[model samples]
Target: MLFVNLPVSDLARSTAFYEALGLSKNPQFSDETASCMVLSDTIFVMLLTHAKWRTFTSRPIAPATTSEVMLALSCESRAAVDAMVDAAATFGGTADVNPAQDLGFMFNRHLADPDGHVWEAMWMDMSGGGASA
Candidate 1:
């Protein structure tokens, strides 16, 4: 809840990916070895080198080959969501293997960065009359 820490094989590459998404890093928590990405006022993402990240968790890291969890981020508008997905591609990332689907009240797309980490960009229409999640 307080923060989401992601273990990336290459810190620089991961940092670039996030930067392309319009997020900035807090220099205080960043160094040559790691980058702390500021997602919002309350949420932060600590992008750590695989080795450095392991030190903070006891469980074995999940291998992308067999298991993976896609992280979803909400956007303020449909255009914002599209822009992020486009930025990912320009930064050497890939559009979600599966195309986006519109669900009347929401529009969602998935994207994978160069390191094979998947992120979902989504937009919801609060005025569309759907119950808040």
Candidate 2:
């Protein structure tokens, strides 16, 4: 299983943003300070409030004002990549930091959550010959 922990300024807002992206919340590992968004059986995103996240480490938390990481997720289709970007924009997220890419057999877009974390939504085709991603 894979778990990506993100420090968020507001747990509620972050959770809502992720939910809008179509990830379901798993109440099993949620609390007032943190919530779990399940992307798949083996993939999870742990959204933690700044305060709650501090408990896990002595190092200073990376401010949401900058790009600390660029998380990438795969989409089922090229259209799905665009749909996810649209949903993200509708839910207070922004997809303007980078331009969209189309490599014939692959497509990708970048979106930033309210807290400035960037996510790349991608779709690829490996069935036959096509331009590289």
Candidate 3:
């Protein structure tokens, strides 16, 4: 299983933002200072409050304006990628942080959550020759 941990200034608001993007909170691993959001059977996102995050590391937290990483997720179809971007914008996220990419066999859109965590929703046609591109 893959777990992505992120620090947030507001736990409740961040939780809501991810939930809006189709992640369900797994209460079994959630608490007042943290929430485990399930994206799939093998993927989970751990949302941690600033205070809770400090327990794990003493490094200064990066402000929302800076980015540490950009995570990408595969979608079932090109339309799904578009839907994900639209949903992000409707729920406190910035859509199209980067220009949309379309290369015949692959399509992708970028979005940033309320805390400025970047994500790319992508669809690719692996069966086609474009997979090499």
Best by lDDT: 3
> In what order do the candidates fall by lDDT, top score first?
3, 2, 1
Cα RMSD (Å) between model 3 and the true structure? 1.4
TM-score of each: 0.87, 0.93, 0.95
| Per-residue C-alpha lDDT of model 1 across residues 1-133, encoded as one tens digit per residue | 4677777788888898889888899999999778989988998888878788778887776665532778889999999989999999898788865689788688899888766778899998887567443
Error of 1 at 100 (Å): 0.9
For residue 27, give model 2's deviation from the true position in Å: 0.6
Which candidate model has the greater TM-score, 2 or 3? 3
Which clashing pairs does model 3 show? none
Highest TM-score: give the candidate number. Answer: 3
Candidate 3 stretches greater than 4 Å from native: 131-133
Worst 10 residues of 3 by lDDT: 124-133
TM-score of 2: 0.93
> lDDT tens string, model 2, 55-127?
9987887665678889999999988998999999999889756888888898899999888889999998978
Model 1 residue runs over 4 Å out of place are 131-133
